[model samples]
Target: MSSKSDAKQEREIKIVGFLCNWCSYGGADTAGVCRFRQPTDLRIIRIPCTGRIDPLMIVKSLIQGADGVLVSGCHPNDCHYAVGNFYARRRMEVLKRFLPYMGFQSDRFRYTWVSASEGQIWQQVVTDFSETIHRLGPNPGLHQTVDSAPAVSWF
Candidate 1:
């Protein structure tokens, strides 16, 4: 892609961020409290732990119109549950190896470790991730909007 085209496209990237409540989420909150100016294109979803992030959720986020997905959690051995981030790291490694060949690019999905005190890191991560996705152009997967019907009530 030409530099001119890339520059024009950078203004439209949409990102979905999945942050672990104990660490990354706190980091983001701190960023906010500190008045850090971060990109507004990302929609954040807080999960109890990064291990709770299902790979399908990544695919689903893309399908629902996010051009990129950022999964952030505690550093190795620093998870609130002690080992949850390790499991998350393993799952992300395996998924990273396969998701791109199926259409998603490395820029379309990313995983990172951010601790509660790393507010600047969290801001920078989101800023940089969004910029990369912007430069890569949009993902075709993001155009596939969800169409499933509501689940049956169990009352």
Candidate 2:
């Protein structure tokens, strides 16, 4: 029974989290310091600010085989960098809406606000997102043919 449970854990989904240093990253750190139990599926990447995260970074992560992506930043009006997270919110919203047109599931990417003091919230957020991704299963990325280039050429 233990081995079966371990095997189930081994099949857990893979998720990438992009956390803003000033707030969300601190929240995650606080959660760790508080010994909050959180899922092991999310791998965190710390960035200076959510505003600095390019939409393409999330897209690239999904295309590269990440099962899901989560972006967390400071709450609006509480951002250390003033309105940076507001800009990030708008950009993330656009990306969430545009993902489906590009053949990706919008639910696979999510953005949220987490304050440095919100350790428990961070744990909950990670746990909920992990569960959601597990339900969605792995992202299939773009299915393409050797003879066919992407509809939108990067070059």
Leading candidate by lDDT: 2
Residue-level lDDT tens digits of model 2 in 113-146: 9999999999999999998887776665566656
Badly placed stretches (over 4 Å) of model 1 are 1-11, 142-155
Instruction: Assess each prediction's global lDDT (C-alpha) against the native.
Output: 0.86, 0.90
After the best TM-score superposition of candidate 1, give how far the Cα of residue 64 lies from its true spot, in angstroms: 3.3
Clashes of each: 0, 0
| Regions of candidate 2 where Cα sits further than 4 Å from its true position | 1-12, 146-155
lDDT of 1 by residue, 1-155 (tens): 58658655656777889999999999999999999999987889999999999988987887776788999999998999989989889888888888877656766889999999888998899899988877767765543467885576889
lDDT of 2 at 46: 96
